[model samples]
Target: MSLLVDTANRDTLHTLLLKLTADTKPLWGKMTPQQMIEHLIENVQYTNGTLIPICRRSPEEALEAKQRGLNPDVQIPKNLFLGDLPAEYAYLNLPASVTRLMADLELFDRYFKTNAMAIHGGFGPMDYNEWIIWHSKHFTHHFRQFGLIEGDI
Candidate 1:
């Protein structure tokens, strides 16, 4: 089986995303499947240098957050909103949005390949491996929101 828990694994992401459809409704949030995919794409923007990240947490806070954020087993609480809210989905349609997400994922991988680290608004600076762990946890969170995965990742 694919390493389904590894968000950095392209095949794993692709396999999971194949379960998503426009009609999918989040079990705990207002986001539709398209919105969720777009949100993830926007997240990639921060690491790929498409969007500049503004660090919102103090250094100590960021340190603590990074500890938690990088733990793949840690589950982000349901219905919790981060301080930085993502903009509305572009609604480019499901297929279009998936295409963009795949492209953005490529950029995300490429960026990390060349750069050692990137700044996260809440968790501060993270190396490529740290970022991969963050993405794994994050995608697991969103997948649970849409009921795409069950139990622990």
Candidate 2:
């Protein structure tokens, strides 16, 4: 699939996201549909440095993760074990969450234009192209998890 940096792919992603509703169920994992949307939005926020998490992986580990993640052939492992969300974790209504995600993705396009990059918790620092691949894989991973799209994006 083309990266979200591409207009067509962005449109495709948005179109698929609109299909998700409160009743949608994941093919795997614990997140509700809204939680999934919020998760994606938060990831973009992280990419934009709006929500920075402490780096959990060392530089070498981060690099390894980046390399593996950027590989188009590699899918994110199921039940990958990223720890658990806070007990108080909250989610917006589904539509609102999707809208925010769309807006945040647009911001992602704008973000890289002026800034150099941001540190990914697992991928270390990433530039525009690298972010493209990372975010594309991420979206694909969750979309697949939720059974939003079959196979790959």
Best by lDDT: 1
lDDT by residue for model 1 (1-153), tens? 122358677887887888998888888877778878888888888988788898899999999989987765566888886554446558568888888888887888888878888899889998888877777778878888898888743
Which numbered prediction scores highest in TM-score against the true structure? 1
Candidate 2 TM-score, true structure as reference: 0.86
Backbone N/Cα/C clashes per model: 0, 0
RMSD of each: 2.9, 2.7
Candidate 2 lDDT, tens digit per residue, 66-145? Answer: 88888877777887777685454355478888888888888877878898988887788899888877887787788888
Clashing pairs in 2: none
- Give the range where candidate 2 is weakest over 10 consecutive residues by summed lDDT: 1-10
Candidate 1, RMSD to the unseen true structure: 2.9
